[model samples]
Target: MLSTVRRLGVRGPAVVAIFLIGLFAIGCSGAALQGVGAPGATAAPGVATGDAARGPVEGDQNGSGNQPPAAPADPLIIKTGALSLQVTGLDAAVTAATQKVDGLGGYVSGSDRSGDGENASASITFRIPAARWDEALAALRGLADKVLTERSSTEDVTGQVVDLGARIKNLEATERALQAIMDRATEIKDVLSVQAELTKVRGQIEEMTAEKGHLVEQAAMSTLTVTFSLKPNPVRTEQQGFDPAAEAEQASASLVSVLQGVATAGIWFGIVWLPILLFFGIVAGVVLVVSRRFRRAGPGDDTPPVAPEAGSAA
Candidate 1:
């Protein structure tokens, strides 16, 4: 009986004691009944209370409780930026900057030029070895003019990292707890509940793990937005040839102006005073002839009336 009770699990010891008590009570009751000469009153035969006493121990309270699992720390938040520059020149500077990064085991993430005309600017996202971000920023400043602008930022991911770690740990603990329940569970409903909870906890763990991974990645690599301008330096100024197309357009406009001037001259010559010029010419010619006739006629003042000279007398 003792061995069988022991095989019954955690509640076996207490159940054995209770069964012993019941037996003692029954023996005493039987003896008294015999002594008093009462018949059929010894003790009612009943199922042992030990069976009811056998149950799960307080396993959850003290056995498994330990110091709570600590969460993994998160990476810090970091950022940087620089002056605007020409895209072509950006390669050299970015190369130089990233070289500094490589020396520090950093890398570039994004690079692009945006807009057109003078509004154009180049932006690059680079990562620096976390330990050497300050050195990298110093190197980046060296690539710009006056460091026209500079910025740095930090976000405390310690709390968030710890939080994610805690959440993930909690999910794992919940999974273990559910496994325990699942092991002992007999009812289909209890099994189903444990399975569902375990599945949910596993999913939560995965999600938290992914989040923590992303945070770690971001923290491990520092973000730097490098903006550079093709510095207007005489030393590095590249001589630019005149735009052929613009020159051609200007030539065309000059030709058009010449044609326009010719057209204007022609119009003025034709429309300005040709009719008045003809009138003045005719009047001058008449005056010259009359003067000549008068001069020929010497002292004769009536020389204009001498037109009927030869055959028109009839």
Candidate 2:
């Protein structure tokens, strides 16, 4: 009894893992085997044996052996776009956009409004059907006075979608196999272990299923983000559309700026150097005044001006 319990504990997870791995392998092998056997299906060597073993081979409606019509191809493209529009009125533009999206059998996923009146703006995100994406874009453009920005992108998720589908199918198959194992399990401990594993597997299946659904939705619907504003876009005045008056105005502004700069420099110079200049000026003036007084006091010595005559006076 002890040995059996220990063995069950050790091998429980391994068995589950192996079963899941086998299920996945089988899922993958079916597609590969179908491809390989399609050519051999009608070949001489295999035809008799294949038909006898398979028994009453299923054929097309008209009794032809040809395969039925293929399923419609999935686009698997996640399309998205961004548009920036300047409109005459934000509220009116939003209203028009809402109507257009509704008419296209789509919905506004999100929206935001900001400011008021002329300063008003709006941001809206839409989930438009892939078939109507072009029409919706054109309709949105008509609501705008100017198209500020327009951009679009596409992501091809064909491989991811296929992979997710395969994974989900494999997981589902594993789930069924686990259920069968649980039904056959007689030991309480074994049943509990299997139940735990089954729960885990179901969780994984649910997750994968959700992921696949999201992928399908994204591929079927295209996302559009539009921004609307009451502000009019500035007209583009190209270099070739040059105006002489504009040029003259710019030149005048430049001249005024230079003169302002000069005046500011002059004011700063006075603030920084005026006190030093005043001190130097006062010192020079005093020195000149003192030197003149000294010349008069020492050289004159109460004597008047010296006189020159042609001959000595008696």
Candidate 3:
């Protein structure tokens, strides 16, 4: 080797360049053989091919942390029920309603009762098992004095649940890929980079898990609301004053009133007033004729008696 260098360079600058290039190539080939120089070594298997080994390994799948967390379970669930009623004796009604809900595998989330001292009402929010939701609604209906309002809503996470499953699978794959990179990483930089990626993946997994848990809880349970009002019971009063004389007078008065009404109606219908009207009309005409005759007679009207005296003499 020294003889060859001596021949190429007593100072052959090209010889020096060739020797350096050859040394670099040898080093690179060695690194590749060791799996250190290959881009495949550092490029994430999950990013490239989504390998189960490279993507999701056993424990870190859900992103909780290195401790193989519990296998992913069903998502959480939430349930709600709301109702409004106008009933009497709100205090009693609220208690009864609460008890009913509790007996059906439920509990109250909140309660309120207030009013002026003279009048008051109550409201409550209750949670019931999803399994008993329908029964709970029926129970509330039965207890309603006057059902003012009722409503409920549901979200089907079935599709969401299926999608969650897919997301979890994807995250788990990413976690496995990170784990592989971490395990295989010989360089400190590579190790740190993989750890950062792992942390991000874990965070994402945690978020999804939390979301899924909430959905599952909602699916598993339901919520209920009960509102009630108080009102006085209807009462019928008994008359305290009874008078036999009053009773008799009332009956007599009633008879008189009925007769008078009949008479008035008969007059109105021309049954009684027709004759009176005719009589008045005839009298008016007779008076009118007499007035005219009397006016014409003047002083001569008194001399008619003379005829009577002549008749007697004959």
Candidate 4:
């Protein structure tokens, strides 16, 4: 090396310095690339080891790395049913249904009864907890002598609920952004514009929130409508024996109805028709008398036959 430097003379030291600088630069670049490629070499200070070493979880929120798993959401379902029953006694059935609803942590939302005795019927609407819906139905059915009709239906609202939640969240975020913009706004027009947008978004959020609440309530509770009616009396297979008293009573009623009709007709003839007929009869009599007098005193007869035309008699 000393010999080669001596041969190179003046340029040798300068070249040596340049080569050394290049080698240093190359070494630094290689070291930086290695550090970047290594897993933990570039981790910031104060970062937890567990966090740095951890990978993204399967259900991380928003795909953010290293987030804890989220809990699963419950399914939402709306249940409704209707039942028609024929009972021996309508009032008794209604009372029993009320008691059953109360026992099952439910209440009668509406009740209506019409008619009385064997012809009576009742309609009852119940709000029952979803968990005890089937139990309540069974208990209510037991109160009736016979079930005339039964209907039940269910609706899944999980997707709707989830969609509402996402929409609300997005609206809220937009509301926050608008609020921030309004707070920083200086011009009146800008503030007003932001306020209008904010108001619209808030209104939508409120409407959706109320709808979601209603859906949740429906999912949590079920509605059941029950109609209760008295069982019909059995039709007689044998012909009923004749009863003289019943027949006589029916005949009497018919005779009384006929008499009433005759009386009504007589009253009309006496009070209304009699006066009109009397007035017409008197007027006709006067006209007939006048006509007879006029005929008996005719002009030629009253003149004594005008002396029978004297010239012609000669």
Winning candidate number (TM-score): 2
Clashing pairs in 2: none
Instruction: State residue 28's C-alpha deviation in candidate 3, in Å.
Output: 36
Question: What is candidate 1's CA lDDT for residue 9?
Answer: 41
Better of 3 and 4 by TM-score: 4
Candidate 3 residue-wise lDDT, 45-88, digit = tens: 22223222223235645533211123235434455657778776
Q: Number of the top candidate by lDDT?
A: 2
Candidate 4, residues 3-32, lDDT tens digits: the string is 222233325443343233223322322122
Instruction: Please list the C-alpha lDDT of all candidates, in the order they appear.
Output: 0.58, 0.69, 0.60, 0.68
Residue-level lDDT of model 2, residues 1-314, one tens digit each, is 22323444435544544443434434542342232223234322222232233233222233222221222276578999999998887778899999999999999999988887668889999999999999999999999889999999999876666655555544554455556566656788888887886787777778767887898899898999999987655787877877999999999999999999999999988997897899999999999999999988784457777887758653
Query: What is the per-residue lDDT of model 1 for residues 1-314, given as tens digits with 9 covering 90 to 100?
Result: 23333333425456454344334332332131211212222222221232234322234343322123343343366444444334336557767776777777877788887765445567778877667788877777776555666667777675566556544533454455446546666666666765775676677678778987887777777787777555443465678888999999999999999999999988887887777788899999999999999888786565576578577776
Worst 10 residues of 2 by lDDT: 63-72
* Each prediction's TM-score versus the true structure: 0.49, 0.58, 0.50, 0.55
Using lDDT as the measure, name the better of candidate 2 and candidate 3: 2
The C-alpha stretches of model 1 lying farther than 4 A from their native spots are 1-66, 69-88, 114-120, 186-188, 233-314
In lDDT terms, how accurate is model 2? 0.69
